[model samples]
Target: MWDLLDPYSYEFFVKGVVAATLAGALCGLVGVFIVLRGMSYIGHGLSHAIFGGFAACSVVGANYYVGAGAWGLGSALAINAISRSRRIGADAAIGVVTTASFALGVAMISIWGSRGASFDAALFGSILGISPTDLWVLTGVTVFTVGVVVLRYRALLFTTFDPEVAGASGVKVARTDALLMLVLSLSILTTLNVIGVTLVAATLVIPAVVARMLTNSFAHMLVLSTAIGATCGFVGMNLSYHLDVPSGTTIVLTGAAVFLLVLAGTGGRRLSRTARSAPAPVRPEETVSLP
Candidate 1:
């Protein structure tokens, strides 16, 4: 295995591994909140919205990262505002913004294809082509995301578990929710750059789902999810290299498989425990009543 993964033989593989590790760590950390709040869709929505920004950047020959990041941030803020208003529910608001943003992005791409810049790579990621500047941006995003999650840990947890009680206790549930949105935005942007606009949602949800099955504690789930994501990245990259497959598709599939395995194992264990703990049925004639 060591010989097969010798970094000296292939430097690009090493870069891919590092990028995956950081991206996975960020996803796992922020994804815990996503799972708790049942807002995984928000991550998916933000990623789709980024395509508009990327299209705009390509049209003007501007920096793609700047365009994507700015547009993703704008979408996040819009979702937050719409959710706060009584006019629409959270999921509904997300649906509206994400759908419109994605459609607009597609339109922008069509209009700007007349100029230069390829859309396929941005739509699906270019891991092997990640530049040094992109690596630096990825590193910064990871750090900022992890730091925000850590700092707001208690408030976020309180809000997630018992929003009404936490709010009464001065937890500021709305602020925490928005803060999570911000962290998720950062995670989405980084993952999009690493994996591409189309599949970044997997990084935000798959590992977290797998970890939930393997562990009950939030902290443990986060750690396990990060490990699962990192493993998938490295393994998938090698498989793609050997088989001449797309790395992003392989990695996403690897994540899906891991989630299924974890789910099966967890379900099996619970079923066994349920069977053991079940009480025997009483005879029809036998009746008991408490005084």
Candidate 2:
């Protein structure tokens, strides 16, 4: 309806819509792998870790994306490396590293009194606050993520389902994990502007989980999750402007609503198995059980 489209008469709304859509889609795409690998905590933790960088950069007058991106990447790698020790589990590593980073941010905020960027905005979100630079950064990250998935589909898929098998088949699990963490770090950096650090994990998680309930095929899930996320972003942005709600809150609520609808429609019966147990060659040289 024209009522819905009227907001675009303002250029800010237009940019908000685009940014939200791309941010949501990127989170959904990466979330599929994160969910399959049981790395849901990583999403939550990395967002918190990025917050530390956000606060530090804001205080120092540095480029937020660059500094925050590096900090997040380091946190992710540290978690991955610590988990690999077999001494500490991934969950513990996430809890320790990210929480420490988050604590650092809190300390900085208390000390600096929220200097450069709006502390409230970083914690929450403001779609109207989006700039041309933010949009371009978001677009670039989305393109890069898509490229990584497309070009390295087999390895990523394998890594998600069965890293042990993947490693046995010369898949280089460590490198794949590092690359994924890199993508995730950048995505989180871009996503923070649209949805805020608080809600990034939900944006990353909800769409992928919803898609999983709809289908067992990994490829189908990817497509469906991306579509769902984009839909939520578009619809939520419009609703937020009309309702005067925070754009990030509205977007996540929209995804949650979609989740409930799918949950009810599916009757919660699709609680099926993952591809970890069964061994099937999806293609020659790829011994992944593509669920």
User: Evaluated with lDDT, which candidate comes out highest?
Assistant: 2
Candidate 1, residue 169: Cα displacement in angstroms equals 1.0
Backbone clashes under 3 angstroms, per model: 0, 0
Cα lDDT tens digits for candidate 2, 46-147: 899999999999888888888888888998888767666776676876798898888999899899766577776677677866899999999999999999
lDDT computed for candidate 2: 0.84
TM-score of each: 0.84, 0.93
Q: Write the per-residue lDDT of candidate 1 for residues 89-114, one digit (tens) a residue.
A: 88887887798888887887676562
CA lDDT, every model vs. true structure: 0.69, 0.84
Worst 10 residues of 2 by lDDT: 281-290
The local distance difference test score of model 1 is 0.69
* Candidate 2 TM-score, true structure as reference: 0.93
The true-versus-predicted C-alpha distance at residue 79 of model 1, in Å, is 1.6
